[model samples]
Target: MPRKFKVTVNNVDYDVDVLEIGAGSPQAMPSYTPIAAQIAPISSVPAAAMVAAAPSAKTGPAGAGDQCAQMGGVVVNIPVKQGHSVNEGDVVVELEAMKMKVPVIADRSGQVARILVAVGDGVENGQALLTIA
Candidate 1:
C-alpha cells in the first residue's frame, strides 16, 4: 500500500507522494521543495545572530535569553544568577536525572536575566532551566 503525508519545512508545507513497489501512476512526479534548505552546524554558535545589533533594539544577542533545564531530577544547585555573565558550555543546571547528577551547559555566552526554576524543584524535559539577557 502507498501512503501520503504532509510535512512543513522552513515555513512551507509539502504534500509528498509515495510508491509501494507498484503504486502511483506513470505521470506521477516527485517535487522538490524550493524554500526548504539544509542546515549545517560548523561551530558552537551560528555566525548570523552573533552580529552586533543597532543602537535601539536591546536584544543583546540570540542566546542572551536562552536556558538549559534539568531532564528528570530535582534542581540541585544554581551557581549563576541574574546579571551574571557566562560563556558557552558553562554548567547552568545541575540536576540528578537518573541516579546521577547532570550538568546542563549554557547554550551560548551571555548575561543571566532570569532564573525560572528553583532549587529542590523537580523538573521535566524541556523545562525552563535558566534565562539569559
Candidate 2:
C-alpha cells in the first residue's frame, strides 16, 4: 500500500512516494501491484480443470477395437472389448499422460470390431481408438 507516483505537469498535479527518480526525472505512474510471485498460488482448483487434465477426449476407430486416438490419454486401461481377438501389435488400450502409460497397439489383426473409449474416457490427439473388423 506504499508506492504512489502520479505526476502531471502543465495543469499542475504531483503525487510522489519517492523512490529516487533522477536519471532524466519523470516518474509518476505506478499503481497496480498484485504480483503474488507473478500470480499462481491461489490453487483452489479450476484452471479449466487444470487444462482438462491434459490432452483428454476424442478416440474411436483405427483397427482392432479401432483404437485410434494415438496420443491423447486417460483411458489408462481397457484391455480389450467388443469381440476381442487382437494380434497385429495387441495392447488394445491403455493411456495415461503425465504419469505416462499410453499403449493402444494392434494395427493389423482384427476381431474387436468396436469399443471406442471407456474405463475413464478422455482421449483426443488422434481419436478413433477401436474397430478392428
Candidate 3:
C-alpha cells in the first residue's frame, strides 16, 4: 500500500508518495504529484497596508514601528505605554505562543511613544509592538 501527501515549504508545493512493503519483492520507481499552494501568512497583514499612513504605522523607531516579535502570538500584556520610560531589557510586552509566555524586552532606554498591540490582539512577526523615542 502507498500513501500520497502534499507538502508545502517556503511557499513551494511538493507532492510525495510513500509505500509500505512487507517480506515480499523489491520496489520500483516512486510517483510524485504537485498540488496547489497553501494558505499564505502575507494575507494576514498586507505589506502595502503596513506601509500606508495607518495608526499602527507610527509605532516604532523613526516613526516606522517598534521592534516586532520574532514569532507570531497573542499579546498577553503591555507593561509599557505612551509616556512611560523604559530601560534596555525591560519587559515591554508579553506574548503567549505555543502555550508559553514570551516576554518582549526593550533594546534601549527611552520613553514609550506608543504601544502598538493591545492585550488579546494577535500579532505577526516584524509587526510593531511599541515605539520608543
User: Which of the numbered candidates is closest to the native, going by highest TM-score?
Assistant: 3
Candidate 3, 1-133: lDDT as tens digits: 7899999999999999987666554544444454434445666878887678444422333344365776788999887768988888899899999999999888888898877678999987667788888
* Model 2 Cα lDDT, one tens digit per residue, 68-111: 75676688788887887888987888889889897878778879
- What TM-score, over all chains together, does every model reach? 0.49, 0.28, 0.53
Superposition error at 72 for model 3 (Å): 0.1
Best of the candidates, lDDT: 3
The regions of model 3 sitting more than 4 angstroms off are 1-65
Question: What is the C-alpha RMSD, rounded to one decimal, of candidate 3?
Answer: 11.8
lDDT of 2 at 77: 82
For candidate 3, the TM-score is 0.53
- lDDT of all predictions, in order shown? 0.72, 0.73, 0.76
Q: Total backbone clashes of model 3?
A: 2
The reply for model 2, stretches above 4 Å from the true place, is: 1-36, 47-56, 59-64, 72-86, 90-104, 111-123
Residue pairs in candidate 3 whose N, alpha carbon or C atoms collide under 3 angstroms: 60-65, 60-66
TM-score ranking, best first = 3, 1, 2
lDDT order of candidates, best first?
Answer: 3, 2, 1
True-vs-predicted CA distance for residue 41, candidate 2, Å: 2.9
lDDT string for model 1 (30-118, tens) is: 66655535544547555675564322322233243667453557888898987899998888779986678988898789898888778
The TM-score, computed over Cα atoms with residue i paired to residue i, of candidate 1 is 0.49
